[model samples]
Target: MQEQKRPQFKVFNTPELLETILLHLDNRTLLVSAQRVCQTWTVLVQTSPAIQEALFFQSQEHKWHAESISSPIYNPLLVQAFRPFFPSVHEYPPIHNNTNENATEFQAEAEHHGRDEDSHFSFKALDMLSSPQKKTAYMRKEASWRKMLLRQPPVYGGVTIFKMHHNMGGDSCRSYEVQEETPQANQENKESDDDHKMLKMGHFFTAFIHNEDLYFGRFGHTRIYWSTYVPPYESDLDGRAGGSYPPQGGSYSRKVIENFAREIVRSEVVAFSREVTQCCVGGKTNLTQEESLRKEILEAESDDRV
Candidate 1:
């Protein structure tokens, strides 16, 4: 009886065996586990293009689980160490070398804008705009939004609205048009384009001082006619107010535009995930493991087709 202990049989080996083991596992958990197993497993999981594709496919099938996963463990200290040499977001424009008089004036302006007042802008209006049911509910609650122009005193300045033309470059320009909508027009347009067209909403109006006076307009609306004067800035198109604008001529850099685009993409992804979770979970039977597995397989096959 004392000599009855036998050797433990090892089972995992070969690509086929590994793939089989991975098939039943949740994608994100598998990825995390693979990453922690050993240097060999990490290299296999990370470097193998096939495995990477499979992981994404599996993850997409069970995306609701993403909410439960831990935040990505990135090395912040390492990131900081290299940040100066490899800046993630572009650097802010250099401060102008100025006399004390100008510096004081700049500081005052910065303090006024730097306060968290910008955070009040809400994207709820845009969300309502996107959903027919919500739009109806919103209209029932607030029948009409009054439009008013608040006049600055004569000593401060006045405001003006102008129609700006967009240059679409080449023959494609003919397809682009700007149509201002009244409430009735907006409803009509929504109904007409319900099946075909996608609406592009501009970020909320933001006021910027240009030539020692304040000017405000929706960010994307400002782009209806491109101007050398209006510098680019990151903005949430759905928000009630436009985001902060960089210094004059500061936004001409490609990096600035790319960062803005990335923010938009991130927002889009969040919106998409929320939509999926709401529709999938609320409308029918909860997604089953078998169905999720089938979806992962189909997605993986689709990747091969691509």
Candidate 2:
């Protein structure tokens, strides 16, 4: 036991090795908790460009990096930013836009190989979007939500909950509830703490390819007035020099792929959309109420048919 004391471990001496380790660290730990560990670590993490890039690339904006790290995730803006680090494809995959009839054709091929080739081909939007943000988790969350929504389809009340993005990189995406015109009777009696707690953070976008499905973003959000190209002299002109790009409550697609996704998700997005205001994503009461109401209504309607 005394002789074992002679075997002292060599201390990690280089900042580069530390940088790589820090880069690999969980984002929250690195930002909120890790830096506070020690002065040397704080300086190293704060000053390291690689760490900064890693953090930036992990933002909800880079839904692809989180959701689809294996195959090429198709966001031009993010691709440009990360082009230097990207593996150069010896030959660019042929543009499948329009030339292919099925927008989801790539999915069939992915499915054949199954998880053997790609674990994330199924594209778990919410799984990739968890608070701590893990890079490679398979997600059926969206599919499960779809089943829940479609099982008892809601009346076309319009988008109750909308998650919309800041164009390019304007601001974080946000959700707005339709704010129910019918106020609850016990509104005043309800404790303030009982009110739905709004989680302020989420991912929203016009279009992204996840598994076989075309998702607007990893999360849901509605359209905003942000657009670079404002089509003027159109019949439905937004009544300004630069009108709302998708038009308010209009088509959310901007790019070719977005247009395709609009077609795919339109019915699904619309059926679930309602007109409730200030509703928060995953708000306890709000979420429970919506799910319960939809479940009841759908079941009742099915009974009526029976």
Candidate 3:
């Protein structure tokens, strides 16, 4: 009798079928796990246009496409992956009034969600290069997130990172704000369009590491006062230049939603820093003694707290 033959799973070998299936995955899974499945999967994820757009590697053009996405989709691989380092505005009670009645409410909500208010929320300026996550998966050359975009479809404005310091009776109240770039009518917009352009994960990390003092500050401590505004949509615009526009919580058009997101992200792009890019990507060996020591301390604190 002839030996029986077993069937081969040929579906996995088909690039078209594989691409379709892979596109269904969330950005994190696609970057962290799915691409590691096989050489074929790796190639498909790296090369497929649809997959690239979904990963935020390339810009999405359609207004309908942006509108269809209901929830606020942050950079899954960049921001979400290292979420602890980037706290949203909602994370804290108004920085000025930590002792306000709402502080209890915010703490209750944070606790109810299994989040630690102290660890997740920090008023101190933190060097992201010192974040524990950087020493692990993010530092690897094979990390797909390094190539990912900071935001999907690429917002028209840049990102804003401000550190605010308020001194009340010698007690300094400090906090950092990270929001999308606000479009000022000032001459600052005179810079090239690239100045307002979004950055890839690698480029963003490079800028953050190099512009450490500029962003977080080095002078024994002072507040970085910054304000953001909402641009009135054409329909919502009144005769008055700064008159009341529609409430933010109210329904918004695709244009309004996109514009809001655009202002938050595209206000002022950081100039790329080639020097620190090598330090982060290659290894910490090139980092100064102070930076290396700081990184170790932060990583240790994280381990101990856990």
**Cα lDDT listed for each candidate:** 0.29, 0.31, 0.43
Candidate 3: regions farther than 4 A off:
1-8, 63-72, 89-137, 140-143, 157-196, 212-306
lDDT of 3 by residue, 1-306 (tens): 122332234556678877888888887788659877888788888888888888887766464375785333447555545453334422433322323233344434544664332332222243334565755544555456655665554644333433222222221111132333434653356543343455556544443444353322221221111111122233333222122111111112343333333433344232211111111344333644445544554455355446
Q: Per-residue lDDT for 222-302 in model 2, tens only?
A: 222101111212323323212222322322234422332342233222211112233344534333432343344334334
lDDT value, residue 288 of candidate 2: 40
Best by TM-score: 3
Minimal lDDT window, size 10, model 1:
268-277
My TM-score estimates for the predictions, one after another, are 0.21, 0.27, 0.46
Where does the lowest 10-residue lDDT sum fall in candidate 3? 270-279
Higher-TM-score candidate of 1 and 3: 3
lDDT of 1 at 61: 18
Candidate 1's displacement at residue 163, Å, is 15
Task: Extract clashing residue pairs from model 1.
Answer: 204-242
Per-residue lDDT for 187-288 in model 1, tens only? 656544331122111100111111111112222111111111112232332121222222211133344334433432222110100000122334446544
**How good is model 1 by TM-score?**
0.21
Judged by lDDT, which candidate is best? Answer: 3
Clashes of each: 1, 17, 12
